[model samples]
Target chain A: MTAVLEVEDLTVRFYTEEGVVTAVDGLSYRIEAGETFGVVGESGAGKSVAALSVLGLIDSPGRIEGGEVRFEGEDLLSMDESELRSVRGDEVGTVFQDARAALNPVYTVGEQIAETIEHHLGYPPSAARDRAIRLLDRVGIADAETRYSDYPHEFSGGMCQRAAIAMALSCDPELIVADEPTTALDVTVEARILDLLAELADEFDVAVQLVTHDLGVIAGTCDRAMVMYAGEAVETAPIEELYYDPKHPYTAGLMSAIPRVGDDDDRLPTIPGTMPDPIDPPPGCRFHPRCPFAEEACTRTDPALVDPETGEAATLDDDRAAACLEYTEGLSGGLDYSVEVAGGTGEHVEKTIDERDEGGPDE
Target chain B: MSLRRFVVRRALSVVPVLFGVSVITFGLFHLTPGDPVSQLVALNPDVSAAEEARLRERWGLSGPVWRQYLAWLSNVLVGDFGRELRTGRAVSGILWRRLPETIVLGVFGWAFAIAIAIPAGIYAAVNKGRLGDVAARVLALSGVSIPNFWLGLLLILVLSLYLGLFPVLPPSRLPLYHPETLRYLLLPGVTIGTAAAASVTRVMRTSMAEELNEEYVTAARARGLPERTVVFKHVLRNSLVSVVTLAATLTAGIVAGSVVVESVFNWPGLGSEFVRAIDRREVNVVMAITLVTAVAVVLANLLADVLYAVLDPRIRYD
Candidate 1:
């Protein structure tokens, strides 16, 4: 399937007075048409920066040091500001984090949305007004006709987010990049918003790139997931494969950290150590210093992703590789050195390493 | 604030304040050491106490001080500001003649200032560290520092003496009431207006620059709105509350600030008339002018509060 959006080896940096701080480093991903692609990472992992970089929205001092971002076969980086602006609201809509600040306080929400319609769709004033009301109703704003005359401050937080969504959808764009769109909302509101977005994406046949830190959200809502660590994509897999058989240790740690409903006695597992600074990353493998399975080789040399043998599609098989040295075959585990017959290739590798380090398992 | 509540609250609040001001101004004029009766007799020499008393009573100075103040305040409340002491003309008639000229100079000056300052501020803010930003900052700094009165004199010397625009002094009995000579008001109008504009522009630029950095503006751009729309529409209006508040106060500032400018050009507005009244110690005229100015300031502030409620919905009367 052809990708609707393709980003390759993207690196973003800010040249501050102190030094250049790398915000996003060599991250790559592809989103196919009509798919919900999720980028999951903790705060400061550069998920929002990557999203902003796609729209050419990064200001001075923060520069796209390297990469190619192509949307429907067009190089977004090569386009001038005017050309880029034409594509921004017309072709790609954005639902920002805070809905309240996103809408202007002075004007009515309908008027603001109508402005977008008029700017992109060339509708006359009266038609634009009608279209704005329709869009607001579609977002579930009640009394759409009379509410059109009300200012933004009159609406509640959830209502403001709805208004923001209405404004975004005014131009009927092909893609929507929502950066933590539901973070500031309560859980009930969050569920409704996600459902609304999923329904809208399906109905409109538009692709979505949802950026969030919630592992459960990505697992439940996204078709595919990409885990970002220290500004790099460590793993990308189908959501089912990612949840049930997470390959990367970081992904495994993330899954173990999720609070299962009835498991109240024991604490949820958490990875130790704060998120590393991106300005000057730890040498060799960026995750080595924090990885529990780190060996001498893991610290001395970086490991590139390799296709795991229990593979799916050819494209996905290559896509699921992890940057861990233990994933390599024959280097640390072999027949003469290995004693126990493990159940699968991945289990065999983990057992052999565990046995070697612990001397022997209990009888 | 509700429209009715706002209007009534503002109207009621200003009444007692103006009454108190009238009393103080009336008392101060009477308390001054020099005797206005002696000054008037000395000037004319043939006038007696009977003539002085007639002049006083004509200007409504015949009653006790408190009674006179109450009478004047009540007259003003009923839209009758009595008559001028020297000319025996209605005060409202005088204001009708001079208020428009003051407003004309003020509006045009403020418009010019907003035009220059907004773009300059945006340019400086957008190009924060570049040469253009530095140039704009320097210009704004100078605008804030330079006195408007001094600038008015400089404009007179440069534009009037060298360029020989209209006469240094505006035409006596300005033909503003007529249509044919309207353009003649341009130079004097510009002189006063530009001085006020320079200060207002600096204010707008500072406010605009600060507001451009707010997260809402960033949010607007992140939504894929054009850069210009984000700056001009989103950030500009949010930032303008301060600018408007400052501009509202300018009605009073320009009136007060225009004293030197008006005197320099002999524009025959209240400011120039005020300087003459003070010098001659025309107690009744001075008290009348002070009362009028105090009312103008109080009314301007009241208008500003209403405009504030209209421009920003977040403010409430409760």
Candidate 2:
């Protein structure tokens, strides 16, 4: 399958009074046509910034320093304002994280959606209004014709998200970048919105770039997942493989942190330390500061993204790649973790590490 | 509540406020150093003591202050604001004659203020941190800092005396729509407008800048709308909600500033008439003008509340 978006060495930086913050450092990923690609990371991991950079929505002080964001083989970075305008809603749409704040409060949701439709699709006002109502109805808004005149505050959080999704789908964009679209929602509503997004993606055959911190969401909705740490992708793999056999220590830590139903562990395992300061990041591997299996080599040398099985540098289309010393056999102190597959293809595996060297009880 | 009900309630609520204002203004003037009777008698030396007493009784100045206030209040309730002591003209008639002029000047000043403020504010906010924004900020600061009367005198000096662009004194007996009348209004209108425009610009700039930072603006831009559309249609519309309140209040302020501006420009408006009446201690005329000004401020606030409801869908009147 052909890729709808090919992001190569994407770098974004923010120039603030404090200093220059490298928000997204040498990030590279791709979304295939008619597939869901997830970018999973903790807060401040630059996931949102990377997504916004794809759409050229980064504001002043935050600059897309370098990289090529080729959408459908067209270089988006080189496009002028007018050209970008034509490509934004017409080709790639974005659904923001906060649904309520994402919608214009003064206008009705119908008017906002219709505005997108009219602008990009060149639909006349009446036709756009009709299309807006139909879109709202398709998104499961009841009595959409009457609700068209209602303002955003009249809708609940879940409803607002649905309306936002409808707006993103207004011009029938080929790709949609949803940044934590369900983070502000409750669990049941999140599920419904996720289901709706998945269904819509299938119906329209659109590529999706789902950015979220929730691994469960990635497991449920995405075909492939890219785990990010400190503005860099630590691992990229198929959903099942990443869940059952994580390669990078950071990815393994993330996988083992999720709570299981039948487990007897009193406390949930957590990755040590927070994200490093972006203004002056640690030298070499960005994750080496918090990584449990870090060696002297990990701190002095940055590892390139490589296929773990083949031990070769991976390209944009690689099926599985991880940036770690163990994959390259350059580590003096090796990762001593073993993955215990729980059961089926979709179940999460537990990573049990030898903790004797770290002062834990010997097992 | 329904819009009609909200409006009626707001209108009904203003009656007590006006009553309190009228009472305070009446008492303050009565209790001040000068006596209206003495001031009038001092001007007319030929009048006998009996004549003075008769005049005092006729004007209801001989009764107890509370009784006099009650008498005046009853007459006002019946739409008889009494007669001016100096001119023997009905106070209501005098107000009716001057009200149009003041309204015209106030409206013109308000329009000028909005015309200058909205664009300047939008420009400053759109080009924040740029040279144009710096210049606009300095202009707004000067506008706010300069006193209206001083600005009026300075304008008259340059535009009237030096440049001969407008008449020093407003042309009398001309209709409001006449070009001559418009030229006459330009100097005073700008003088009063600049003071208010400065404040309006500040408010608009701050509010517009804030709304531009809101997530909806980013969302709108992400939807492929041009920056102009995002700033004007989305950001400006939301920003104007706060600006509406400021604009209405400033419009009322224009009426107040006209009192000083008219004196400097020698323009014939209610402000000048009110100043002259205050100097002569024309209690009836002074009370009438004060009541009118109070009513104007109250009405402007009411209009602001109603506009708030219209502009913000989340605001529901109850």
| Per-prediction TM-score | 0.86, 0.94
Model 2: how large is the Cα RMSD against the reference? 2.9
Candidate 2, residue B108: CA error in Å?
1.2
The residue ranges of model 2 lying beyond 4 angstroms of the native Cα positions read: A344-363, B1-5, B41-54, B62-67, B170-173
**Cα lDDT of model 1 by residue, B1-318, tens digit:** 576787788789988897788778778877776555566667897898799888767667667867877786687667676665456667667666766666665565666667787777677766777899888778777776777777777877887789886567645565556653444455556656654565666676677777776666766675557888888788777777887788777777777865776787666677776788688665555666778778888888888777777767665444
- Cα lDDT tens digits for candidate 2, B89-190: 899888888889888888888889889999999999988999999999999999999999888888888888999977887545687778778888888888
How far does residue B178 in candidate 2 sit from its true spot (Å)? 2.2
**Which 10 successive residues of model 2 chain A have the least lDDT summed?**
A354-363
> What fnat does each of the candidate structures reach?
0.50, 0.83
Candidates in order: C-alpha RMSD to true structure: 5.1, 2.9
In the order shown, the candidates' DockQ scores are 0.49, 0.84
